[model samples]
Target: MPTLPHRLLHRLRLPALLLTAALSLPTAAAPATPAQRLADIATRAYDDQARFDPLSATGVGDHRFDDQLPLSHAPAERARRFAAWRGYLKELAGVPVAALSPADRLTRELLVRSLQDRLALAPFPEHLLPLEHMSAVPVQLAVWASGQGEQPLRTVAQHEAFLKRLAGLPAWCAQAQANLREGMRRGVVQSEPVVRALLPLLADLAQPDLARNPLAAAARALDTPPAGLPVADAARLAAAYRTEVAERSVPALQALHALLQGEYLAAAARRPGVGWGSLPQGAAWYRQLVRDQTTTALTPAQVHQLGLREVARIQAEITRVAPQLGFTGDPLRDGGLLAWTRTDPRFRPFKTEAEVLDAYRAIDARVTPQLPRLFGKRPTRPLDIRAEPEFTRATASDHYGLSEDDGRPAGVFWAVIPDPTAYSVVGMGALFLHEGQPGHHFHTALQLEMPLPEFRRRTWINAYGEGWALYAETLGHELGLYTDPVVYVGQLRAEISRAGRLVVDTGLHAQGWSRERAMAYWRDVTGAGAAQAANQIDRYLAWPGQALGYKVGALKIQELRRRAEQQLGAKFNLAAFHDQVLGEGSLPLAVLERRIDAWIATQRR
Candidate 1:
């Protein structure tokens, strides 16, 4: 039986005490620092982009919109996206970099540069030339549905979602065709060779066989039930998937192929040049592409000169290695070291595909023992090597495809084995290093594992990533894998090829070099096989300025390492220097320099 006064006192006592404690504490919580605010902006920007670019979202392992596919190549839609980029750039510009922490400043610079590059090329007619080997929408969809790409097909929901995406193919291809039609009107179409190359690719997609049709293959491949799902449920889902794919996706692909072969191919034949310079506003467009890819102001001419210097330097190295291999043949003669070594039976050690794969595996195993000595951190995911799929084998470049950290799909290092019976094993070690351990696999997987912001984790600056891989190729020498003279020559030739890309890529697009001239120069300099020369030249035409990133990035990294070694002297730890370079995943070459400079300053202190 408590009185009113007693009850009131009990309730008020707690409230009164709490009020006194609050009053004694600080008046208001401190506002977020400028760096924190900028970080928030980055997070928001990534989320916004993920929503807009569903394909990118899937690639980053964000399954929020696994079923959605954007008609990004549609001219009006593309304009809208560009407008949003401008708005984002404006907001980013308002941020005060001077007030940010060093790390935050780097982040701000990266985002700013990324936006600026996108904005710089926004007005260009890239959409007109969208369907290239590097990023063909039709091929990409089939690849996605086939369960070989980033698209997930493990769950019943995922499989259904993929069907929806597959269904979107007709609309996407129609938009692409419309864009190409506009390009034809404007004389901004792709080269004849590039257009002709698409025929075989289209034929592969038009296969009637359900087991062979890439889209249908995705559904048929679902032979087992996903976890927790009954066998009947899985079977039902697969059957439904096959129906949509056969009836919908297959027809769409056939229609698109018809459009390409009948209309697009004829149009391309009427106008043919490997260079974008052949189009309206071509020179300016080429310059902008250079800026976008390299993130530097160096002109195509300057890049050409740099390439010449590197070619001579690497050629000299190759010549030095030639005499040691008992091949007295002139290294720079018409055939050179490349011709002799490639023809020599001793260099072609692998008689079978299994043996070739084993060599790469051995390279991985050999390099694994030495990784700790050069790198402080190693990616948890092991690199899985596989033969490139038949559909893409002709046009496919050897590359590294990253996997999710969840550990289901191991990162793949695709080795494009064209002639299995007589594949040359000259530079397999360096190639392995570039595409596998300590190169792409290390740079990409480590980035995924890092405690980085979402954008930083996923952002791929071409120069930084490619340069790191090229630099990784050099590490094979230090790791004792390049002990053989022939292997050393192989490494030198690979370096020369990268250097030659600088010369040849610019020659084709910027210097007004004809396709014939470019191919001739490639043969004269690197003595590359005719097939190799043609494949690479087509790649450059399809993807302008991309080839420049490798040499530019590698040279910058080599310079930084040289500077670090000089400044730190006895204090410079190779492992620590490598850790800093790869610690932040990929960076623009400029940001990388700033980061390395900061590390250098810290070491000096």
Candidate 2:
């Protein structure tokens, strides 16, 4: 599973701010038409999304709704929200796109499509099985409260707001129980591994020791320590966690665990796959997800076929380079390349997490000088590397952080180091290239610095955002970074992992593959251990079709670059092409292609 960039939270919350900007745009000379009025209403609807999910808003740099948290598990509330969304969409359809400017028209289309997708996903009971290996409400809440991940926790007021937010945890936990009960009734519970994994998480959080607890860590960091507070207030909050763990969070987790152990686990089908084709309406839901993720009309079959071709092509490249790296025969079958890369002494574990971060910083120092050659615009903010917190490290992915409005918190590239030895140096270079110097850090930082509309700067299309990072992986060779054959192999291995995801994700959900089957396939192909493979599979189970984005997106981008190079011939400017891609902010692949094509035509002229 791909780790989301911290800045993405800010992007998700930008639609509302964009709505405000849309409203403030100077009115046309004439009185607004019905179409214009409808567009305004649609804009308002998009803005309303912020109110429904305030935590999401805060992530996007919008502090307007900082104090509110969404009630995601309440069915009645959700139904009412969806109904309002649908009504807005219906009303928006009456507006003529031709009446609005291009940007506003795109926003209208995206909003309508987003609403329709939400409506489509509503009936699936996804809310019931929301907590998974990839994300849990508890983890997200902790990050939100810590003032570490996009949320501001600097001032006394902010601290109080977080405590207020914490006070609602019991209610949220109860809602989660309600959702799980609903899932059990509908036979739509999470996988057994996920449920089992969650048990320990609950146990850890519910432990009597507040000082060591990740949940209480934030409160300790607050200006007014909970310990020094009025006894009743402190006792009340502490009791809430106690009751939350023992009564709500713990029992609910245990019951869910029992359901998985007793029924779902046994009945759990073999093979990990992607999509919802097995269940009723599963196929249609998956189709929608592919569309939403890729922003294209390509079918799952098309994506699967494309994955096959990509795997073959990438494997051939690997085979060609194997002998040069000291492999004697059939690299894929012998597993020489995989073994050498994974167990190489140079990739040994760091004694301390600081050493691990120092490695990333070293890569940045080496790569920054070369960035100006590849990219005309670079981020002004500094890049720092940090270790993921121990509690969530097991499930966290290597992520990049976004800068705040004040530019105080530099963008950070966080690598989750569960075990030091697992941080392979062979993989680190390419990973750094993708997440640090020329990948997310550069791309996202550039977006923030751009003068694009507020929404475009902050919002992202997965196809473009992930595609750009994937694109950066290939840029290493051009940027002169993947000098060692081992590093190159790491790049290929990364590609293979993404390609394999298409196969395994589809296999799990669509083709009824079990967890063991999926893990085995990943281990066999990527040489990832059982634990790592299990984590990846569970992530796919948690969020279907998300893993498919990397390769699918990367392929589209590679295709565009190839076409651009062929068309422009000697006139092609690599730097210019990169600028064209990054400068427009993130767009759906289709829109990106159109923008690129227009740029190409201008260059040809």
Output the number of the lDDT-best candidate: 1
lDDT of 2 by residue, 423-514 (tens): 67778887887777677877777877777444455565677777788789998898666778877888998888888888887777667777
Candidate 1 stretches greater than 4 Å from native: 1-33, 223-229, 404-409
Q: List, residue by residue over 1-605, the lDDT tens digit for candidate 1.
A: 00001001111000000010111111254236767667766776666666556665566566777777667677766676666667777767777888988778878877887666767776677777767665476776666666666666767677788777777777777777787788888988888778777777877777667787766766676666646656886788789877876787677778878878888888777764668788788889888877766767889999999999999998888878888888787889875988777667777767677778888888788888889999889888677887665667787788877443233746778788877656777878788888888888888788878887787887777778788989999997789978887677778878888999999989988878887888888877877778878888888877778889889999999999999999999999999999999988778788789889999999999
CA lDDT, every prediction?
0.74, 0.66
Q: Could you estimate the TM-score for every candidate?
A: 0.91, 0.86
Window of ten residues with lowest summed lDDT in model 1: 12-21
Tell how far residue 291 is off in model 1, in angstroms. Answer: 1.3
